[model samples]
Target: MSSFSSLFTRRKNKNRGRTSEKEIYDQEGIPKHYDRKLDRNLCSIQELFKQTTDYEEIHIKVGDLKGCVCYLGTTLNKSELNMQVLEPLREAFKQPETDAHRDLDYLREAFFPAVSYEYAETLHQLVWQMLNGYAVVMIDEHSKALALNIGGTDKRSISEPSTQTIIRGPKEGFIEDINTNIGLIRKKIKSPRLVFEDFRVGSDSNTKLSIGYMKGIVNEDILSEVKLRINKINASGILDTGNVEEFITDETFTFFPLIYNSERPDSISGNILEGKIAILLDGSPFVLIVPSVFTDFFQSTEDYYQPFFMTSFIRIIRYVSFMITLTFPSLYVAITTYHHELMPTPLLINIQSQREGVPFPAVIEILMMELTFEVLREAGVRMPRAVGQTLSIVGALVIGQAAVEAGLVSNVLVVIVAFSAIASFVSPIYNFSIAARLIRFILIIMAASLGLYGILLSLIVMVIHLVSLRTFGIPYLTPVAPFKLKDQSDVFVRVPIWGDRYRPSYLMTKAPVKNKDSSRPSSPDQNTGGKKEND
Candidate 1:
């Protein structure tokens, strides 16, 4: 048998190409030369604008000279650019000492006033500036092009995250702007140790992604691996962080998510503190956290907001809910259809009596009900919010009552299906719940084939797949399969606040403890002394 390394090396060598072909097609297929060439002689800014079709507005203004044109890529605050860029150039052209080449620096200084604006020396830098929403000013004889930083647009304000909503935690969520998202994380952490590394992934889109992590906290090897994977992602377009995540993820075929995604800044910050890397895309609200574990899906921001005991109880409930959601319906069918002796005598008799008039077998009954439920769910999601609620309530009542009356399914089966649906909803992550729903279908089929033995076989296969999976080299079943006691405080059971002094062990942090001062208040009167006295 060939080793994994040898096989991988052989594949790499087979796919290897010369410089020109490699530039066009990296390990991942992406054409490098998407942008049109910038002609040195061309003074028509409209020519440059014609190359990029993605931008909605590309305005060109001829100023300073017959050849000099100010090229604006986006529609953001065009009035300001007209005033700041074109106005100064017009004034300079009117002057007697307006030597187009000699007075260019002075004109820029007088116009921008802001110190950050700089001139692009190369064609690559010029193109990048245009892609980043900066207006480029080019002259006939000038060797350099001026890039302005006056990007101001009317965008949606930071709002509460629709997906990762929490009741007791911070209501603020990340917006589409990458800079704003980074700012939100910085506001929450307020630590200089946090590092934000920027990378441009897509060849055509040139979409900006910022990888955030704590300097000494994150495992260097894992961090490097994540960086390498991201750097190697050579796609033509990356509309969201989800695209980057899917491209860089270790497993593409698995149903379970390797990278944990969240829109809440607090959650991303928490992961960063735990030595996990977060990828924030420019146009996406959700940030992708690397080195995600299975247990991470079961956790929510509310877990930390509530008391440790309450959180622990809730965590236990979620774990139980997950199991019930996945196996309960299958187990019901397996025992009722094959292993009748496993059921109590009274229960078996009751089930048999109830199912007497049913037209379908146990497996068929389950499949029918599950399929109906899934259709209703999809309809509810796709419909308008107000109408969707009405549809769900009316549909559930109508379907349940009609099915029982028609004698297609037993009352016990109805109850079991309903319980399974409710159990699936108990999952904190909606994506995780969807995954559970898919896996439950497989489990049901397995149960139908070989009863309980098939269910056990499915479980073993699932466990093997999970154990083989890794998110940026961190095991998917981290702190559980590897059995890290320190991290177990927050997994399976939430330990007390004081007991969980360190961060998750899977991260391999240099300083695991987030708080040096773990002491509780000595007295309630310490900070509230004045209020107490006044009362």
Candidate 2:
């Protein structure tokens, strides 16, 4: 594979004419901010883009001067470009007496009806503008170019979120376009304090990423930390928020994702309101939320939408499932292989009966089943959608049953692995679920080696690792590790919205108390003295 830097350099230097070959780019390979002679500028740009098939350029006469419009054909909106930008300018310059050199500002002020346009003075800015689906107008003898936002709306329509689906909540999810994702958040939060700061990463791709936070609600220190880490990213290409997440994450060796990502817009909006910062990357539907804690992965948007008590109960079930997924196989291995007395009398007999005639020991049997289930899970994900469900069902039933009947593995081990797999699915974040899956294997090996003692040791190490991890300066096991009593209302069990009015104490938001009203609502009789409406 070609390095992005070399590929970009080759493209930039492909078709240059030997005229005035001064070094245009600085040490960092960014074009210098100086106005080249018009002919030289045009020639340099064309040479930079030479052999590019999708680039479209239009040369037009402007009184005594020459000018041209350039844009990428694949991304630019043709109809909007012509009707909004081209036609008006063409008509304005049609008058024979119009002087292009002097009337440039007049044309800009009087003629162009574009919704938004910006001036780019250097090749650096102009190239970035054109790459972002803007039409660049270069005029002769002019030091600057006009970049018109003449529509780049080619994107997937807003649809129900596929990844983080909820039974009752807003069905809207983020699309690939960064602007649309930001607009979704703005629609939810109509406050003027909502801020989106843009940053460009990737020297070759120049992928646009935006950090969004409520000006008053977000923690300034955390926001600054996030920006500092993002600005420190030096890469050739960033294709998705995952790329940015990896670059800015606090911990890389750990299995747990330091940054949380979600496809649902409502979830992101809720997090923003709670003083969390969101990072939106272009060309990816998933948006990342920072300062993510352990509980954030277990909590869902539906938790807020449903009754608090029921959601709380479900949240407890998720925590239980998390425990089961992580340790069920390990416990089974430890107990059956080393400490058989830990099992009850009947259960031990049943497990021993099932293991009779099994070809491998308990640990080997469990590993075989776990690895087979993992393969099935991966196949279910990668296979074509038409057969994915069928594949999962058949693999679980047919393959597992065959292995048990063949005495390759015990039926009890199969049940343990299958139950563990189901429990792993309870996590809302797929990345978090993957962490559980990974730790499950390590735990199985430890249990096999040192039995329950090894399992306990691994658990202690995991706790230490979790406590040591931080997401943008916030504790990974927050609200639980540091023991922030005020923030517990929404951590393990979410309290009623009225009962919990303050944002998380960790963020240290400017306005900590979002709701200063009474925690309890007054009954109708208490407010009205039991009087009828007619009275």
Candidate 3:
């Protein structure tokens, strides 16, 4: 409860400065400022929400003042509305007050000391607050309205992150609620240097979003670029970070994701401290990290929580899996079609025998199998959880066996396609894996047309495309293509935590050195190095 209070108290401060629609200007429709008359202000607010079925206006009194509280019916917590707002007003009404003592200031200081609130100076601000579950108090002849945050405590409980799960790490994942998400981050990184700037996006949805970064560590150029892109968003609505990603991303023509997103708070916080910007949307559990690189997608937050050598090995395996998933089917097709001499005599004979009864060519066989695998994958995702896994497994087995037996596809082709599909799942970040998945079809086509030569050309083109890509002016292939010897510590191989003493050089962080204590951990016995216990 105390945590929630502090969260909101800080949130209120963050939201106070931001009333803009993308920081350009507030949404047009309502009056710019509040009118002196109470009924006039109430009427303006009411008309804006007249179409809203949940909008409610309640009449109330405080001392000699009469006013109304306007809010959405289902948004507020009833208990808090009574105790923090209504009860205070009623208690204050019991005491006598002179004209100067009965103003908004009087009500704020004496009654609502502990409450999270702010002054809504304009009718636009008032309506915006009401929509966000704030109960606004408008006194007779007072132009200023007091907006109290009586928003409900209802939100999905934090559970293990389903998308990016790990055996060892914090089990708590980010929830849909933005406050809860920020609180989770705040808990992990308790530093005043971690700053969050708020923005109200979507002219219709008015969805809130915040970009959080370590103030001193973050690059000024990168931070400016992030804010610029976010402010330039002209969308009608932004339901999730996915929508925001499309708008702010540098390039959309490529299959690769320009930004990284995660459901874990630790991942976002860790990135923030590392001089990367974390963009969190109001209703999304996944937070987007700016300036994502090719290597960043291969990384898992759990990697840091485990042994460094094991993580490095796992990352190497992921890279191998990426190559296998991307080219295994193509390689099989190329070998069988034109590069048959590359295979040993026995293996070639076996493949030739397998292909003897098959009607379709190797290319057709693999494409058909790949398409079927994709259809089954989609079904598994869209179906009920209880049956989804069963259906996918059963469907794949039945289809593969039937195809091989009926000579629709060779047995080798089935093995190749299935192995490729399994390898595709090895990537830590799902969206990053999709690049290889999408490019695989093109590679298969190349392999079919010109065999091994076409496959090599296709791979060269893919590399050039990746090297050319940029996210927020940062190279997509950081530390590898540009070749920074220092930043390579955490790329394909994660050195011990103490060895990785600097942020990624590509980010151009304000403070490059991350480790205040750069010394590697040593045994107590090693510190005493052949000396007596007293020494």
Candidate 4:
């Protein structure tokens, strides 16, 4: 901690002297709105989208209004578009009253009263609408084109989350469809204060995304920072939430995932309720939760569902496992190579016997096993589910046994490596486990070089790196580093539901109190005497 003071001070001072982008770019702008020419609009649509097989347009003449209904054929509901929209418009246009009113407003009021639509004023917007499954209603000489919400984009049914599964919790998970994901969240947290601001990211892809949060509960500063970062992104295309996450994260070089993401809608809703913001993107199941701290990754949404004691115990195990996964291999290398006196005589003898015929050093043995396990893990993930799980388990056991019999690795080292792999999986978030994996190699290298001292130094440096990082200006360590007593209830250990009444203080949330604090509840008979005396 004392070693990096001057470096920290210099970095902090450097950061303070930096100028904000807001001062440079004084104003923001939007895309160019096209002129109100029907033929030109149709020509532009044709020139831009005609190359695609899904591009579709139908010329519509309603009295004097000569316009076209354009949309992607792949996403359009042909039956509904014709029967509900086109038929009504054609019949309404044939009416005598249609001759008097040649306006889109009248056209809308008379025919589109039952449908949802958007006015596309630019070719970009029109293209976007069509791509997203809207049928644009363009007038002959009107710049504003009404886009009907008749998009029939195929979406998969919501299924159980592949990861983050709990023994007891909601089975429904988010799907690729953004609207459905939002609906799943809305189902959990039905509140007017739940506001979502939509943005179109990726200049070429124009990917639809929304940042959702409780209006008054969320910290406005962090919300603003989120918006500012997202608005600043100039990526050509974003295929997944991971892409957007990279662009908006506070730190670029950090191994830890600064943002927490999940496929479970309940988890996202739970985060939002606690004053954290959720970034939902179209065409992606994973929703990114912002203002994430280090502890956030260690936790599972399942913690809230179970009894507090059990949950607390599980959390403690996770924390312990996290430490073990990070340092056990390094410790083995450090102890066996340099500090042989530290190991028990019997255990040392057993290990020595196991390593008698092994060709590689302790560090090499650990690295070989780790790499083999990683290969198996990757292969299992890439392969089909049925084969993947079987392959990972059987392959690890078979290979470990084979290597042991072949005098390649010590039996004890195999156990350590296997246990380490298992511990890494205990983390609820996949990327969080990855951080430990990456850091383990660094620790191993250090341990091999300088034994226990190197291991300690490596750990201290890792801690410093974690503490130095921030998530939307919130310290990565949060309550742990600063030490917030109230927030601690739910950090390392979760207390009874009523006992922990406050949200995490580090968020600087507008609504800090989760609910009005109440006394711990008891059975009716147990509280009867107290109630009688009070009455």
* Candidate topping TM-score: 3
| Model 1: per-residue Cα lDDT at residue 451 | 97
Give the C-alpha lDDT of model 4.
0.84
Q: What's the count of clashing pairs in each model shown? A: 0, 0, 1, 1
What's the CA RMSD for each of the models? 5.5, 7.4, 6.6, 5.3
Off by over 4 Å in 2: 1-38, 99-101, 526-535
TM values, all candidates: 0.85, 0.91, 0.93, 0.90
Higher-scoring candidate on lDDT, 2 or 3: 3
Q: Candidate 1 on 30-73: residue-level lDDT in tens? A: 22332222343242334455566544333333343433444444
TM-score of 3: 0.93
Q: Compared with the true structure, what per-residue lDDT tens digits does model 3 show for residues 1-535?
A: 2321231111222222333532333444667768888888877777777788988877887656788877787888878888888888887777777775457887788888988898888776777677788988888878689999876657899998988867898999998999999999999999999999998778677799999999888878677767767776777789999999998888899998999999999889888888999999999999999978888889989999999989999999999999999999999989999988999999999989989998888899899999999999999989999999999999999999998889899988889999999999999899888888889999999999999999999999989999988777767898899899988899988999988889988777778999978888655676678565897
By summed lDDT, which 10 consecutive residues of candidate 4 come out lowest? Answer: 18-27
lDDT of 4 by residue, 1-535 (tens): 1221222221222222212222211222323456688887777677766579988788887776787888887887888889877898788667775454567787888788888877766666676677778888887777688889965856799899987776899998999989899999999999999999988777667688899999999987777667777777677788899999998888889889999999999899999999999999999999999989999988888899999999999999999999999999999999999999998999999999999999899999999999999999999999999899999999999999999999999999999998998999899999999999999999999999999999999999999999999887777898888787778888888898888788888776778888775668866555566465456
The alpha-carbon deviation from the true structure for residue 394 of candidate 4, after best TM-score superposition, in angstroms, is 1.9
lDDT of 3: 0.85
Better of 1 and 3 by TM-score: 3
lDDT of 3 at 42: 76
